[model samples]
Target: MAEDLVLDTAIRDWVLIPLSVVMVLIGILRYFVSKLMRSSPAPDAKMVKEGQVIIRARNLKSGANFIPPRSFRTRRLYYSNEENGLLHVPKGQGTNPQAQMFSDPNMAMDMMKKNLSMIIPQTLTFGFVNFFFSGFVAAKIPFPLTQRFRSMLQNGIDLSTVDVSYVSSRSWYFLNLFGLRGLFSLILGDENAIDDTQRMMQMGGLGFDASKSLSAEKDGLDIIQHEWALPRFEQRAESVLRKLVK
Candidate 1:
């Protein structure tokens, strides 16, 4: 194993400071790129009505217990009646459950735009770091790392004797890429032009077919166990009275 060597302060001036600055700038740029790429969805009257109806029915199922049974029956009849049930689909109304979701073009378009945003910055950064910041140990964390991270944290330099904790310039940039998010948020407000946390989360769900999301949501809604909240009022009052007396 190579002996440990102290890194110069010049590395801080030339590598660490510069890499940190550039990453923050790049994150802010990507934020705007994503903002410009995002297009607002068009309003769909039918879809809006469908959502409202579904919510109304679900709320009634779990919450309408306090309505007199006759009134509840009437309301349920209004929802379940063969002519105009809220939950029932009309014969020709987008019969394929996933049809609407699959046909929507916005998610695909947004995904492409976001991918471009991520790719451009990453590619540019790789080339930039290799060109200008190669062959120097940039920074070290407070803790130790194993041999596994040595290769990852030192891209251009190759030396068995070098400590794994001493990262190369490019490695420092990559580390700052993911690590300085909190600092970025502090510099640029929580919902500002530099935040990509939400964007990254959106990326995770991007692989899922939009249709599957709709199907999953429907499955979830279908199995909701509706326990009425009002039936235990009399027992509750007695218990409260007993507590007061005690």
Candidate 2:
């Protein structure tokens, strides 16, 4: 077994603390930059109507048992009706996403701004860490970690013999980048733009497909076997009342 390296206190002071502080400061800077660059486009009326229809369908599906059978059936029919229903999008009627993006220059601009805000600072920070603190063992984790954690925690360090608990400065930067989400949330509130993970997920996800979403909600509403619960509740209430009287 490879012995653990004794990390210097100066390494923690100069590399670990400064790197973490830089990451936090960068996150704050990114949040404000994104806020300044964000554009609020007027929502399309049809899109708003479609979104509300989906919300109503979802509510109906979740609360189907609570409402009367007649009301449930009526609500389901309003959305899932084969003809003239809110959720029924005609075949071949879905808008091409590329075309939509092309048609709206403001949307494209907003996307560009978001990308710039996310990418530029990250690239700069990464370069700064690599240039200054590369291969420096910054700190050691308190708990034992498996060998699988080597690549994750020891980034920029080429030494395969080093234990996984020793975190390199570059990896420390990344750890602070992702791990400070809760700290950023506490400082900047829950909805702040400091979360890189959320931004990455948003970048990966397909933007809202209205037709597909509506179709899915319609299918979900159609399959639900709603049973009214009021009668069961009434019986239970009567039983409780009788017990109280006795």
Candidate 3:
């Protein structure tokens, strides 16, 4: 009788424990999957162009990263002869870069001093809050899943006549993710980076005009991709502007 009771207890443990573990695993997986599905950003050809600009900008490193501390930087934008039609133009390859600024150091210092109160805290708060929430949301989503979703969704969406509004909507997920990561330099006290970021924002909207000129009616996925890549594009545009200004 004792042997039979022992065997029965062992069987109950094997069945109940495994079933509980499986259910818990399933629930956890579902929560993660739901968050991921909600965070996918639509992508297309226009997005590809924006991504290329970002890559080029990173190559240039236009913002304060190139400046020395206790010195301020100023830049101007102009059209380029070699790379005709790109919105953010750089200086000609052979030009003397330093001859452009004359007696502006004092002015620059005054401007920097005046902006310290607003710029520093504004940058820090913006960087920290944006990074924290965006990072949390990003941590819950996966790019692999977003890419897969893009493939599936692309089939149903019209490729032509896509407007900026829809494109922006699709990219809202990505805006909530890496957009946060991009804000960290300021909260960590990188003034140069913040200066660079402000310059990029001040520049004209990232090539939306160029896109509109090239295509009268862009497709939905194309718009989503284009808008999604704006942060990177802005960075690239600043580099182009810096070269022209110098």
Candidate 4:
């Protein structure tokens, strides 16, 4: 019996302990890497001599999807006038390269593939860690206290920011064992989260109105000429300054 106990202890320390440590490390690394990728700045255009704008209608009619037309739409703003007390652009010359990307089926497919490739690995890595280490960490603690501690970790380190890449790992695990087992409902919930994040990021960082951008009238929205939102704003400011100087 003593010999058996000694062997069991050795196995626990050498095998189980090491495995547990490795798992925890992998999980943490996964989380940080995801954070890095998600937080990477969206492209900026100033370096490349570009401009960006989020179009707002001067007097968009009520209940209408304030957007531009498709075939007649032009990308770059090379026309100007006044209409109904606001700056009016009747017909414009030049075309926006960014705006043109959506109409190309091949380009759209390529973009989607690239995005999915970036998200999948980050998500899976996080999932693996959340599934394996979270439980292991919970083992030493009391039942009632485990959830509370886990919740603390999640809120403190997880969803408070934009890191939604590995949500299936952290958030879904808690949900599944915590009585949320309906697979269909869970999937729908994940989709909603993803959609929400995409919308929020586009609105806040890119100043993009996806709805308007997608409609029959696509030209109405201001074209983001160069890259990200910051440089676009900067470019506009510089243009205003130049006009003042001249």
Candidate 5:
């Protein structure tokens, strides 16, 4: 059996405390910088209307069973009608996202700004930690962790004998990077740009296709089998009333 290593208390005070504090401060700074760099362009009215139409269509599909058959059919027809439906995207109305980005200078600039804000700070922070605190054992977690957690928690340290619960400076930095999201959300609002995970996911995702969304919503509305529940509810209410009377 391997013996547990006793870590010096000063490591926590010098390396762990400062690293965490600096990470938090950097996150707050990044949030403010992102906010300042964000450009607020006036939204297109047609795009807004299209988004609302999709929302209304989705709501109708979700609550179809609750509404009367006549009302449900009317709402469904309003969205799914072949000739004049709101969800119908006319031919040639959809523009390629790449072309749209090329045509709109502001869109390209905004994307560049977002990329810069996410990348620059991350690079600088990683460099800073690597230069100053590389290979140092920052802190040991209170509970025992399995060997599977060794690669994740003990990133900078290469020794096989080290306990899996012991966190290296590099691993601690990563932990703080992802773990501060809730804290950032509390200090800034929910929509704040301090979250790196969301930024990465946004970079990975396909940009929204309005025409595709409208077509999908239309398809969803068409397939729903709307059965009015009022009569059933009334019957259940009568049964309950009869039991109460008995």
Candidate 6:
């Protein structure tokens, strides 16, 4: 805790630099590993047909108010009719659509693969770093860290009385895990490397909710209520003509 006790400057070259570089390298490697292992399901006839139907439905709903009420009704019935509709999808044959979405085999497998791609390398990296770099003080935070952060920031260092400013090599590695976005972008370009911060946020529920997205989309599609605006077109035109005459 003493201001007089400064960490040797060589620690930056030996510990901080190497650890940061290694963490970055590992991330790049992880990206390729994920890409190689990632076997995204190809869009087949059923999926493509369903997707096109959904797109058409969405376009129709967006522009529904611009068309005549009768036209909108005809298109809605044509698309939503259960017996012959594109996505008619009979009611009560299964559980709620949202529940069905939850039990979907494809969704389950995709979730598993995504989680595995995230978990496996992180586990291996942390295990390897902790085993090799446990006790050494690796770097210092530019600012103060509270007691709450002590356990998280100081992973391997055991000095109970030491200042919380100094962090262990493993913790430093973890810091670089989320901190190297700019460096990665430079090395791997914009879309090449995954942004770990976004990934972490998603894992923590602060990011996009793909799990409920299908249900949300289905709900949106179900309630595409539109008020016909074209019905007022003639009235508005006549009013404009009267105003011009005056």
- Expressed as tens digits, the lDDT of each residue in 1-246 for candidate 6 is 546356777877777777777788888898788779778676657556666677887788688899877788888777766577655655444234445446677756766787888889989988877776667787777788777788888887777777788788888887887677678788877665556556666555522333243334445656888788866888999999999999
**Which one wins by TM-score: 3 or 4?**
4
The lDDT for every candidate, in the order shown, is 0.69, 0.85, 0.35, 0.38, 0.85, 0.71
As a TM-score, model 5 comes out at 0.81
Pull out the clashing pairs in model 4: 51-225, 52-224, 55-222, 68-217, 68-218, 69-217, 75-96, 127-169
In candidate 3, clashing pairs total 5
lDDT of 3 at 95: 27
Give a tens-digit lDDT track for model 2, residues 1-246: 568677788987888888888888988887788778877878899889999998988888888999999988988888889999999999999887667877888777878878888889889989998998888989888888999999999988899888788888888888887788888888988668436667778865536679999999999988999899999999999999999999
Give the top-scoring candidate (TM-score): 2
TM-score of 6: 0.69
Q: After superposition, how far is residue 64 of candidate 5 from its true place, in Å?
A: 2.1
How well does each candidate superpose onto the true structure, as a TM-score? 0.70, 0.81, 0.19, 0.28, 0.81, 0.69
Where does model 6 exceed 4 Å of error? 42-44, 92-115, 181-246
Candidate 3, 1-97: lDDT as tens digits: 0111112344335433333343344333433443343323344475577456544433333332343322211111111112452333233432232
Q: In candidate 3, which residue ranges exceed 4 Å CA deviation?
A: 1-27, 35-42, 62-85, 89-246
Q: By TM-score, is 4 or 6 better?
A: 6
Which stretch of 10 consecutive residues in model 6 shows the poorest summed lDDT? 206-215
Candidate 1 per-residue lDDT, tens place, 46-108, comes to 667666666776666666666666666666666655566555444555445345445767756
> Which segments of candidate 2 are over 4 A away from where they belong?
1-8, 143-165, 192-194, 243-246
Q: Which stretches of candidate 4 lie over 4 Å from their true place?
A: 1-80, 83-87, 91-102, 130-134, 137-200, 203-246
The lDDT, on a scale of 0 to 1, for candidate 6 is 0.71
Residue pairs in candidate 5 whose N, alpha carbon or C atoms collide under 3 angstroms:
none
Clashing pairs in 6: none
